[model samples]
Target chain A: MQEVLRAHLEQIIPLTDEEFTFIESHFILKKYKKHQFLIQEGMPVKYVYFVVSGLLKLIHTDDTGKQQIISFAMEDWWESDYQAFYTQTEATFSLDCIEDSVVLGLSLESYQTLCEHLPKMEHFFLQKANRGYMALQRRLLSLMTSQAKERYQQLIHQYPTLVQRVPKTLLASYLGVSRETLSRLSFGV
Target chain B: MQEVLRAHLEQIIPLTDEEFTFIESHFILKKYKKHQFLIQEGMPVKYVYFVVSGLLKLIHTDDTGKQQIISFAMEDWWESDYQAFYTQTEATFSLDCIEDSVVLGLSLESYQTLCEHLPKMEHFFLQKANRGYMALQRRLLSLMTSQAKERYQQLIHQYPTLVQRVPKTLLASYLGVSRETLSRLSFGV
Candidate 1:
């Protein structure tokens, strides 16, 4: 699990043994069972999790209790109620495991300290942030301009494994389509 | 205009006169007339513009030549075909002035030089990128979950001036509503 964290970091910036050790000290490994909540709406977001294994879903529940899937995290991906994590506010979303999972958790304090002490880590985070922004921009554009079928096709093309792992009902929510519509599209009926 | 850039930077990280001067040198001041393009589809994105004054729109045109407004950038906001700018690829979208605009443009090379030579600049960029990602996430959620009217309301509440400055047609496009629907909603009819 620690090796997974080190490998993830090394993907962006080369880390010396001592630097990797220092970086590792800032993260805590945690495991969660399937359906376990890692973050709950209205609770403080204590840490951002980087998935070492398994799957998690981030969702928002409306006043009417309708759940909207915001995103999913799998191996090597990061997840959090980032608005809460960054601002130290209560979460407006919840994160729950879809599979028994292992993750590396970094608290806000540790995040700041790592950036302050390791310039390369700051660069690494900046790259990740920029890529995250770009991904969201692409998603926004797809939502604005693409139809449900196109979006589903995009999801399948981008992450076939994700499409396979996510239940059809959840995938329908993520695509902003009804389960029936998803079924029709998926089956080409 | 330089003061505007300096002020924007200082909002995140305080900088000395010498530091500001060094920072300012990496940017080039450029002015565009209304409807002038700062970036065009299929052209290499050379710089990311930080608006000193006036307005800009980032748009993508589909195969049918129907345009989708990705976002509006006003004074103190940054706008670019960021995917193209970061990846050094041809832009899939175009950025054009809505009003006669002045902006400070930072090239990729200068961006890299600034980040490498000034660690604080890297931190500043990381902050900006993270905030941009959060903003995009919020917009994506709104697009996925909110009705057109709710999305319109969210936009107006978030950027009242932007709502006023953008034409109703573009506003409708941004909210993913028809122009007639926007007219009806705006007038509460």
Candidate 2:
């Protein structure tokens, strides 16, 4: 568990063993079965989870009960309804495990404590946030300017691992298109 | 001029007089006449300019020379083709002054050097970058989900001063709509 956490931290910033130990103590190891809901809309999101080995989906349901998949996270990625989490509001989105997986959970209070105790950790979080914002910007632009085919191609090319792990229907949902449209695009010549 | 710059810096993080002096040395006051381009597409963007006064527009053009307004910066706001500036590539966007204005220019090299030399400055820049990213995220979401009138309202609500200074045509361009549409919306019974 420590090794997995250390590996993830090392990708963003080099952490000393002591620092890693300090963080490890604060994190809670969580196990979830496939298709399990980690969070649901209208409930408060108490924790942000880092996926150690599973796939998670961040989704939102409209008034009509139509789910819009905002994002998918594979191993080493973090997932949360951050707007809700940070603001201490009811969740605007839901999180569910797509595959049976291990996760490290960090509560909002614990994350704040870490930021106060370790400036480097704060820097790492800030960098991750910036990158997330940048990627989302590009994704929005693509969604507006490109067709479904182009968006699909970009997605597969960018996150082939995610494409491989998820079903075509879920992928279609993530792409904000009908499953039939995805099927036609995939098999239509 | 120094007061405005100091106020801008304080909004993110407090700085000592010595630190402020260090930052002050990096800025060069530049004046632009109305209709003059501050930075043009395909050119190397050397500096990020903070508007002491006046209006600056950032625009992106397509292959056929049709332009799309991306953003506008007024007093206390900083403007630059940051992606191009950071990557050392030719700019994909253009910045032009709509009214004669004074701007404090900080060259990319100097700003980078300061970030390396001053940890506080680096933190300040990181936080500012985070804020900029957030604004861009909101803009993209509005563009994707909101109608033209909604976007126009959002823009005016955020920057009423810019709304007053910039003309209707430019405002229409910024909202991704036509001059006639904006006029109709503004005057519709």
Top model number, TM-score: 1
List-wise, what DockQ does each model earn?
Answer: 0.89, 0.32
Model 1: per-residue Cα lDDT over A15-48, one tens digit each? 9999999999999999999999999999999999
Give the TM-scores of the predictions, in the order they appear. Answer: 0.98, 0.83
| Residue B23 lDDT in candidate 1 | 95
- The residue pairs found clashing in candidate 2 are none
Question: Which regions of candidate 2 deviate over 4 angstroms?
Answer: A61-67, B107-109
**TM-score per model (chain B):** 0.98, 0.95
lDDT by residue for model 2 (A1-189), tens: 669888878887899989998988889999999989889889998998888998988887766677777789888888888767766899877899889989999998898778668767776776676567657756765665567997888987899899889988899987878999998877753
